[model samples]
Target: MDHMLRRQIEKIVPLTDSEFDHVLSFFVKKKYRKHQFVIQQGDPVNYEYFVVSGLLKSYILDESGKMYIMQFAMEDWWFSDYTAYLNGAVANSFADCLEDSELLGITKENKDKLCREMHKIEHFFRVKSNYGYVALQRRIFSLLCNDTQKKYNELFELYPSLFQRVPKALLAAYIGVSRETLSRLSISSGRKTQED
Candidate 1:
């Protein structure tokens, strides 16, 4: 499992054998069933998760009890409540599995230790954060500028697996549309194809 995770990390940076071993040594395997909490509201997040398989989502519930999706992590994604992890404060967000999941967890303590022992590990995280930061920025722009039709196409185009793997309501939520609107969009797509 660590071998595969190491390979995933290698997509961004090459790790020497010694560095790989050092990084691998810190990972702890964790599993969760669908709907199981990986982190709960008001709980401190000690671990950052690297997803090997299955889907997990981080969201926050408003006082009215409506959930706002922050992110969805599937294979090869990393997620944690950074505010909770960095400050050692309680989390306002909750992370839960959407399907049975396999994850590699590394605690903030071990990560700090790794940063001290291995510079490459620190660099990898720095680089990874920049990528996630960029993605969040792009997502913000897409939400701000894209039309519903464009958003619908972009989702299918970018993450084809999402159509099959995630539920329709969740996809609708992510796209900032009602379920009926999404259903109509799907039908609209099919009609255009038929006309073509």
Candidate 2:
């Protein structure tokens, strides 16, 4: 688990053993069962989590009670309500475990302190935030211009593990397709794979 966090950080900046230990010391390890809520809507968002294992989904419930999946965080991913975490606002979305999950969490206070104390850590986080922003922009563009097939293909290409780990209905929701449409696409994909 420590290696996982270290590996992610090392991708952006190298950290000496003692530096890594100091960084890790600020995090709190936690485990949640499948279907448990890590961050509930309207609650205070205190911690941003790094997934050590398993999967989690962040989604919003509309006034009509429609659920739209915003994102999924699997192993080695970081997730939270960024607006809430950064601005000290309340969360408007829910983050829940899709499977039994282990996570490392850091409070906003500690995270800010770490960044202030370490230039490399600040750079690392800034790079991560930039990547997250780019991903969001791509997702927005895809939603605006892509057809269902294109969206599905792009999603599958980016996170193939989601196809196996997520349920068809939730996958359909993420792709903005009806369950029947997703089923048809799945069948088509299967036939294509078989022919190959």
Candidate 3:
């Protein structure tokens, strides 16, 4: 867990030995079963998960109970209801496991403790959030502006090798399209792969 955390942090900022130790000391490990809900809408969002392996997703269910995929966090990714977690408000989104997941978690309380103790950890979070925010902003802009075909292309471009492992329906939801539309897009592209 410490190794994984260090690697992930290194991607954003090089941490000193003591800083890494300080951050690692605060993380708590947790596991979730497939199809389990890590967080439900209206719950108090307490933990921000750092994905060690497997898949998790953040989504919102409308009044009709239909889901809108907000994001998927695979290995080395992070997912949480940021608004709720940071502000101590009720979550409007649900995070669930698409596959059995092993995660490193830090609660809002622990993170605050770390931030107060180690300025470096706070800096690490700020930088990491900046990167994530930019990427999310770009993804949202593309989804809102582009056609389905373009969105599919952009998704493949961003997550180069994930199509083989993830279900197409989930991918469709992530790209803001239907399964049938994705099928049509695939056929139109001269691809002949069958779904797993």
Q: Which predicted model would earn the best TM-score?
A: 2
Best by lDDT: 2
lDDT for model 3 comes to 0.84
Query: Can you give the lDDT of residue 174 in candidate 2?
Result: 89
For 42-100, candidate 3 gives per-residue lDDT tens digits of: 89988999999888888887899777889888898888999999999999999988789
Q: What is candidate 1's local distance difference test score? A: 0.83
Which pairs of residues clash in candidate 2, taking residues 3 or more apart in a chain or in different chains? none
Candidate 3 lowest-lDDT run of ten: 187-196
| lDDT (C-alpha) at residue 76 in model 3 | 88
In model 1, which regions exceed 4 Å deviation?
191-196
Look at candidate 3 and tell me the lDDT of residue 32. 93
What order do you get sorting by lDDT, best first?
2, 3, 1
Off by over 4 Å in 2: 191-196
TM-score of 1: 0.90
**For model 1, how does the per-residue alpha-carbon lDDT over 1-196 read when each residue is reduced to its tens digit?**
5677788778878988887887888988899999999999988898999999989888888899877778889998899998998889889899999889999998899999988887777888889989989988878888999998888897788777767777777777778788778778978887221110
| lDDT (CA) per prediction | 0.83, 0.91, 0.84
